[model samples]
Target: MVGNPDEPHCVSHLHPETAMDQIIPFDPERMIWGSAPALIYLEIAVRVGVIWIWTIVLLRWVGGRSISQMSVVEFLLVIALGSAVGDPMFQADVPLLYGMLTILLVVLADKAVDHAFRYWTTAKRLVDGRPTEILREGHLSHAGLDKKGIGPTEVMEMLRRAGVRNLGQVEYAYMEPSGTVSTFLYDQPRPGLTIVPPLELRRLPAPDALSGACCTSCGLVRATADGTCAECGATEVTRAERLESREISSA
Candidate 1:
């Protein structure tokens, strides 16, 4: 019997005996081209193009900070947009209209959050944590590092990238809400622990050769006679290295 061209075909109805074998039949045409008409490809492209442009406009409205220095809220917005924009691109079942609505709602929610952050200090603090002091007067703040779950070595690496050769070069350093480190330098840098060669590679001064010492753990400077760091109580100390005038000139 002839079947209607518009109606879906069922292998089970045609051949009940061979239905089990046809359950997952290999059809290359169906797999590659899908069951939709060829024109659907053009529709998908149009949907993608429109959505891409709309997303760009919405992101621009949200401001560049969303991409550059993302806070927790901005990070979540990125994740939501990724899922919203991707599925409708290829899935024939997902309508472009629904995807567009989803994106609109997501961006609106982000804007609402920004509005709340602008007016409410408590909301801003809760979502994006306040900046924590990592260094004060060239000394590492162990308490602050512990609060932020960062180590002294990691803080030193950040300072090094910011053009700081030693702890004394930094008057203060803060770990911002965006996870970036900000360093403030002193007018005349004092003698402190060197971080260029890294702690592991640098050799410690012998007991007889020691003139001045700095804590190996937190980079706090100590008197030559002092056997322990007053700031961190670390007994292991290395020779304090001074930041040269030539280094300042080069910087």
Candidate 2:
């Protein structure tokens, strides 16, 4: 009662309201603004200013990828910020409908642009930009650099950072849609590669109808069977016959 209304203890409730009947007389209209109209206009202007400033700051900090890959929390933050400041931008009322409509229109325009980019290659190139191919088959293509607006010096810098001193080591290099560079390195190749794995080397049982067992490595399991592993490419018939004879004697 003795302190100013603008003071922390009076303005903000740090603790529960006292049980004592304290009569504090103050006029809300006089304290905040002289009139309701002035208060309303001030509130609206502040809201709009806050929204505009917050949007610019967030966009500058987060970058364009924020719009491309919006998470649930980020999306909600964008919505809440816009909603909180909408009234001040468009109307003097706290519940601003015009500001909301403007926001909705902007969102719709963004969606339309996104859709157009996806459907048309030209549009995609204009909005999202096309991926640049830096390297092809151990060679660096200058055309790719031209398209990406970069020079060989910059490309070399990137390569050095990637621990690659020469272009001969690269198999493929491409720029990603998110402005990230992807590279593939060349490696040695194996010979005589087949579609199926070599299972002939491992020994297994055979039907009783065959006269002799075959080499596990060559797939000569029995004389009557295919007489080939078909997988390993090994063809040793003597080992198969010897193993089969021993099994027959044991039986």
Candidate 3:
């Protein structure tokens, strides 16, 4: 056969044995050896077990960081899961069918757990924990702080992120199951409040003089300078301003 000196032997397929070698070589060393069934299963079990423990520990440790840590865990999960799958794919004696089966089993178990979380309250608590009240009525919940392993500084940070400059402005603050701080403000905010931001306002006293104030104790929309709140009889109030509803509507 005539061929270029620089190119491979293109006519090698013309030889009987050459054609057979190109398709399925007689060299069993490259693709021979059946793995033990028990060993293969054991390997799969170990891989899945390690991955499971890794996932649990990672979430639990970083969960205190809340929203910031969620993205980190999710991003790392992709790399970890890919590594888990690659081992079974490249192992010479491991069967592709077995690898796929293990993956399916994991998926099914995950789905089952999700179902339990949705339907069972106890299961949800075990997995996601309960919403702990960290602050209420301008007072810190000591038990909540201890249970969540958080201090005043962390609480302030969470509040700032939520656009709250003052803790007195918040009625209730909860550490939610999803590792987020949820804040609820009072109905009427006090005016010229003595309490400032970053500090936990322990005791809230009734207002003596109201100049542009809202009754946080009651739903008082209007602020009066001379008298107590007409709606809730609350003397203590915060600064009150009319919310322009040009862009949105309540009813």
Candidate 4:
């Protein structure tokens, strides 16, 4: 068959038994040191060093938020940069110049998107998503939690980490775009569902029967319960725990 003189023979044209040998061509020395000359290894090191320094400079320009509190755009930038910076380090076919250009283009796109997010409210909401209200007025927002794909247990864990003793201590709680929970506590907290003692424990201290009960699922306080939560339709109800004065003073 006539073929380009410069092009190698196609594997399909080779003998069936030899095709596998040609495809794999396993060599221990080639595997250890690669096919390139030893000098090429030094070139690879230089390319990697230059790219590493350039990446550091670009990251500095990108700001601390890109590294620490990455949004969707920033996350995309990281993945793109990883691919761009990694390929040219050892792949002889990929030029260092190409990798640098790719990195620059990715960073530029990220910056452009960031600028658009700042100027356009709709674009910002669509890309990064708006902060969701997880809790309001000592009660969990089931709709907000569902929208954010977070459960009550996760919200309670976040609150507990923030040193909250009970849902009553929180005036408002929001799930930020960075996936962090921000809590605003009341100066004088009302009695609500307790979050202490850990939920895993099957037993809890006896609650005062005369006091009002709170929905264990949603932390909604009611004068009395008829064995079901009105807010979330959960059957579990527990005594509303008040924030002690000492805890407020310590806080």
Candidate 5:
């Protein structure tokens, strides 16, 4: 929009000559949506048919995992496919064969990446990344937490979403590549480190009552209060080991 005479400052003053930038070139020919030749239309039809059927079959073979828990590669594959197919579908300037070639290339690249990931550890790490261990032995992994930029509250929120009350109840919690956390709750409770804080402890066994002690620094519970914390290594001992309620992690 052009600036008003009285409200001149309302306009962008970056360009000295506002009119020069404001002037847009319009082509009369651009208004025309010309039709293509029969051969070109046939090419588009064949390309679309092949790519559509190929995409459906490939996606079906890949299964629901691609949609449900998409890895980085899977997500990229989807986007590239969309971009490749979309341009050819509507853009007449983009040749039908060119679009088909683009789709095929994307699909082949996806397969290649998949094959590499299956066989090569380095490639797998590059594509899917190493799964971050957020919880281990009932204790939150400090390095894991720092790497993911998440804290006790965030971990507790994940546990809550997973329908867990205590970290002692979980043996392992992994931050997967697809951004979903996989938590494994133990059948029996044990004295281990917990990510759940004191204020928000839920229906959990009391630390002192059970075979565990709470860490003075990070609140990770262990088997005993006398020893250093497995999580923070704090020596200060106060084992108020009652299980608390849960709070959604603000982080």
Candidate 6:
């Protein structure tokens, strides 16, 4: 027959076990329908139903960002849910209805929170919380930072990562629900290479400037103010200030 050569029936069964082979003979009662074939099938159906319903409901309530923004408690809940579902999925004795009920309870609880978040402003603010306004009108708000349990140093580090040296560069800044500090640059834009001002040499650092130049292999250019390159294990190697300066001047 013109059919799959690798099909189960297409392969020949070995005659018997050899001296080198270790075989565990199959029990027809255990391998085939077993004692609870009907229940086994029912378990499959229930697990599938729970998984399908929960997947959609969870996504709706938790939101797309939950995958990225899951907190410690949220992560533990996810792990527990997986374990709770596993027993019902594999065991034939466990009623599928019980498993489905558990899943439904979680889904209902999630939906309640989702509804509150959408309809009740106070409830939403209490649970989902609001983004911390870190900067306003180019000024860093110390009160905002303090409220979010973040320090000035951390804010500065975040700003530096956002390619901004001074607070004035940012028109607005907020600590996102995902724990990332989001920055909104002013009309001038943060002084860096961006899509609108592609290939701008203004931000290029001078050869003598420690922050601008980096090692070719490791890209560790910035060191301490004491003149030490800690990044690439090369203390003597300085930035290509002359090249950068020339390029910027020409630009």
Q: Local distance difference test, per candidate?
A: 0.73, 0.46, 0.56, 0.73, 0.61, 0.51
* TM-score of candidate 1 on Cα atoms, chains taken together: 0.68
Q: Which of candidates 3 and 4 reaches a greater lDDT?
A: 4
Root-mean-square deviation of candidate 6: 14.5
**Tens digit per residue, CA lDDT, model 4, 104-128:** 7667667776788788989777666
Give every collision pair in model 3: 188-215, 188-216, 189-238, 190-237, 190-238, 190-239, 191-237, 191-238, 191-239, 207-236
Model 5 C-alpha lDDT per residue in residues 1-251, reported as the tens digit of each score: 76687864644546475543543334222212223454754664576556544664555444332454787667667877889889867654555666676678678777877888788889876556667888876667888877766676666777767766556667889987666789886666654434444435534344564555665444476556576776767775344432333322231
lDDT of 6: 0.51
TM-score of each: 0.68, 0.35, 0.53, 0.70, 0.54, 0.41
Q: Candidate 2's residue-wise lDDT over 9-75, tens digit each?
A: 5545466665332323343443223244546555655665465446545543443334544532245
Tens digit of per-residue lDDT, candidate 6, span 54-128: 654554355323444663224434754676577667655455555565566555656665676678888655544
Off by over 4 Å in 4: 1-68, 205-207
Which pairs in model 2 have colliding backbones?
A: 44-88, 200-216, 214-220, 214-221, 218-229, 219-229
Q: State in Å the error of residue 32, model 1.
A: 23
Q: Which ten residues in a row have the lowest lDDT in candidate 1?
A: 59-68
Model 5 spans > 4 angstroms off: 1-68, 191-219, 222-251
Which window of ten consecutive residues has the lowest lDDT sum in model 4?
23-32
Misplaced by over 4 Å in model 1 are 1-68, 206-211, 224-228
Write candidate 1's Cα lDDT for 19-132 as tens digits: 445434345444345566767766655664565446645654443233447776677678778988897687554556556766776787788779999999997776677888
